[model samples]
Target: MANTRAAWARSHAKLDSDTIADAIRPLVEADPSIKVKSIITEVQSRFNYTVSYRKAWLTKQKSVVKVFGDWKVSYQTLPVWLKAMTAKMPRSRVQIKTLPVYRESEEVQGVRVLHRVFWSFYPCIVAFRHCKPLVQVDGTHLYRKYKGALLVAIAQDGNQNIVPVAFAIVEGETADAWEFFLTNLRRYVVTIDGVGIISDRHNSIDAAIARSNGYSRTEQEYNKNYQRLQERGEAYMHWCDEIGVDRWVLAFDGGHRWGHMMTNLVECINSVMKGARNLPVTAIVRFTFYRLNELFTRKSAEAHEHVRNGFTYSEFATKRVEESFRRAGSIVVNRFDRRNEVFEVREMPDGSIYTINLAQRHCDCGHFQVERLPCRHVLACCANQRLDWQVYVHDVYKMSKICKVYRGEFVPMGDPSTWAPYEGAKVIANWTLRRTIKGRPKSTRYLNEMYSRDMRGSRRCTTCGKEGHSRSRCPQHAGPSSTGGQS
Candidate 1:
């Protein structure tokens, strides 16, 4: 066997000394115990390297191990062996398995398909600034019982955290829906100053605010904002005047469609309330915001950061309010009215009259709520009508929400190559289950079964086959006393 092995090694050991050292470099660093001999042994197991004859050949070239402890030759020889072996090694490609997609089911209803939302849904600074006390509002269809759809709006605090501020899951996204949203919005807004509301631009906003009699102090404030539209030469202001409610339109920018514009605020809320979108109606009603709170909890860091800053809402607190003031003249708004399950787009006489049906919920212009993005027709209507085009649109996106789902929290485990050995080991000296067998009450199934078997219920040594004697404490062992027993 020795002769045959030597013959095989002699034939295969085609490496020079330098190749050996390189092959063992990683092994020696990974484990300090690994020396030249260890590397040679590993290589010998994997390949028939003729180290014996090569030793002398290396010595003539001043590369052989002179003394037993002289490891330099071993180091130099390793690189040579590795160089030859590396060339000889066959390369094989590996295929990776596809990750399983977790199918949607009842248990994971509110789970989002994309990324988890760690914050409140206020996509734009305008929405964030204007809609304070961040509200998590959502809507669903209720066409079976009523002709309209239901919209639920809830308020949240600085932490992207939520509270049930106000909710109106109504019949349709009409003036009635907007009225409910505004009524709840106003009720919530009155509690704070510089109140900003976040909502999708359902035409109801125009109608709800329009129908108010300039009736109360809140109504008067609303009408005052609306009346500003007229003072600024907005085309929709004339419609408001005709309806005896012209005083309520807070004019948006000119030439922007409401649907395209309001998406910022709506999308933000949509992200946070994502999983709830396809959920059963009852579940949405019960724990919609509750589940949202759980998602926010995962973002404890951001919440803490906001709390540290006094919750001074970054969404809008830093905005240049005057910039909005400067752009008012270029904006326009086309007013709409809910008529017989449809919407009537009331534009200037020079402009066209397009119909937006809230009941069937289709706009003659066709961009009412289907695509969810605003159409140019809406923009044209907005421009020709002189509505604040900005209000019809949503806000700009935030950096944090746009990131990948797994980013921000979990970074890859730091390079294992650079990690040092752990400095300390947890010492569990004498761990043992203290509970008694029969006299004592039953604790667990394992313990109960042990007692039933008429055993003291302690672990025994595997080597000695004796109870109370662990493998470390076997009397047959002729070493120092061992410590502790297994449970």
Candidate 2:
């Protein structure tokens, strides 16, 4: 048995691993010529009869080391390899400095972090003595990856252009964030007495002001204004009073503070940036700069036209009005109950204003918010009354704001030569495979004769079940005329 196994091994052994393995597999199978030793049942096992040559061959086989083909390898392997390769490459360093670190009630020295920085110039109001009377402030959510919100402080300039003085991005829209943003913003905006600051009725600013007032020596004057919080917003007024921050009584819009008054310049800014909302962080900032440049361009043209048309910023009418109408006293204060869609219009009487009810479909003002134009109550009264509803409109709802922005000139950014459309994007054809037509049997004599005959045939109308005609030409389709047969 040992001699026979040796002879088998000699004949099967080949030059390469694959050929030797293939040749030995068949000999190990069940056979009559050699009595199988049955030392191992598995075909993968080699040489049941102990042999030195087979042992050496197995040892030198390199253990079938698996060098996996690219397709079979896991995706992470390439990156690991690349990282290893890059470790051999070189890099450079620049600056070093010392700074104070505050931690665990101790001051420690730390290297100062340096950034590649540049200076930017923003138009700021150093003195508010003769500045515009209206200051509009608003907050916007940052567009891209950075999780933060931006507070924009804007005002209408001499050219009727929205001048963004200072803006900041905070971690969140909390009172702390708003206070931090506003404290910095106030440094840029010079507020004159009687100048109204227009902003959403945010509690943070109120809370911060309240905190400041609490620390102020004039607590009596602050408490009087604090009592007026109830008149501002029932919820906000209560909240402010509870927090002891009630000094900004005159700072609010009286009725539905949101509806009658709020600064919507940020809304206009957002509308201008709607096209670039989903862009990358760098792109959004770049686009914002571009939009600013466009605003300046339009303002430059408007400035030239201002001199030609004798126009001033105050003379520029944001709202259209008909000539020959008195805008005062026409506005009757009205309350709209959205739940019931009813409007209660109050007209001032001898002592108090007289109240009238107008349903949702009909306002005493006589206008539905349809077409977004003021109705008669709003038109005759609000427009006639000189009341502004522009404040109540949510930032996104303003169509004119969006329309005016896109109309501004914008140069396409980046090099035209490097720009390329998505690669290999083909219009995929929705191909529907048509079933092959079963060839009609060669016209048999029996069918030909039957169909050809004018009156006699097996074919019949499927609908009416009449003989000698198909459903398409049935007499019922033609109408109850002479007969079922065609002419």
Candidate 3:
């Protein structure tokens, strides 16, 4: 049996690279995380053929490039791809900005290098017209040969579905880059007035919005406010003064923003595009187009089916309303005014009182005002007055509005062979932006408060029988006389 196995293994050891790559292409495309060792093992287990690690690695690389296209070529083909996309979908907007190449401080006249690219599909822009007026903007770094930042503007439709409206690839996250992105966004996609923008407390965002809005406040006046803010240790107040609270803060947004305080919506979209960010520029754009197409189709069908089934509210809103209704049963309500719109609600068990103002669509508890949905107090008041609770629900949460958001269809970009010839200058990446550090690239996300957990209790040192440091790094094991030396 050993002799027979040896002969079989020897015969299968020299597997053809092309054959191995062909067999692994589907697996690689299905999961980019598959290791070379795992591919070799899988090949052996599935095909009963042995392969070397180098061949497996090369095969994976070749298959990936073949499937996703080469990185440099993808950059070169960006202009053509954008032109083809716009031609296929005329309503879609695409803008490419380039700067002349500089050689040792002197510009190489007329030789342009890619500086930024901005685009918004027709379907996305049209869908946003029917969605909420609030938009969340955020930026994430690109993990590729030519390092850059991807800026995204995402909005939540009536169904609470994230609709990506615009995307921009910039040299980096700076004031000018954000200004360029938001300016184009305003000109192309979000043309409606009173549209609220939400983002983090990043300084660049503040400067960009101020510049875009053309704030004419004098520097001395601004400096006075800044000094006062610093003295009071109110940095957020300073930001609000500079960028206008209506643009970033939820309270001052006057219901235009619909109470979205964070850019988590755009961040969610960024996380969804994690794998694609490592691809070349054209591939990244293609991935987004295809992914959004899938999302629009799936969500539109869902909304249509829900409406057909007679659902007035979204699944999420329905669940929340039902939960509030149940909680309303335990509360007591007393009408305070002649119109019966103002009421005092008291929790039976705790004797906690809350003021509910149905006229203003607000409650002292704040949930009703922020969520635009009746809170338990408001629901209790409505129940006591025999008023319909459905009227308190926002129209944006209705199934009809949701269907309208997904009604627009995403047109397909036809075959590349049928594309019009790009008559403009070739757009090449800025060489200065290329990563020069010599080390293996890190694909892991930076640790944040949300993703981090207190693992101190789980960490136990085998050397000292203590918590915190590992056995290899344990101080007890680091001593010269300790038998358990550092590994």
| lDDT tens per residue, model 1, 209-243 | 33442222223444576666566566656655564
Candidate 3: tens digits of C-alpha lDDT, residues 1-487: 5345444644554567777877888887766546788898988897877676777877777777877888778778998898888888899999899988778999776457889999999989888887888899988898747789999999897667899999999998899999999999999999999887877755454443333222212234344544555565566455567666445534445666675655778889987878777677988798889888999899999998998998998997898898998888889888999897899888989998888889899776667876788888888887788899889998888888888887778777778787888887777778888978533444588877655556324676544566676657875445556775547
TM-score of 1: 0.25
**Which candidate has the highest TM-score of all?**
3
**Residue pairs with clashing backbones, model 2:** 210-245, 226-246, 327-384, 347-354, 348-353, 365-377, 367-375, 381-385
Q: Relative to the true structure, how large is the alpha-carbon lDDT of every model?
A: 0.37, 0.38, 0.78
Local distance difference test, candidate 1: 0.37
What value does the lDDT take at residue 6 in candidate 2? Answer: 37
Question: Against the true structure, whose lDDT is highest?
Answer: 3
Provide TM-scores for the models.
0.25, 0.33, 0.75
Alpha-carbon deviation at 320 in model 1, angstroms = 6.6
Error of 1 at 159 (Å): 9.1
What is the lDDT for 411 in model 1?
16
Candidate 3, position 325, lDDT: 85
After the best TM-score superposition of candidate 1, give how far the Cα of residue 227 lies from its true spot, in angstroms. 17
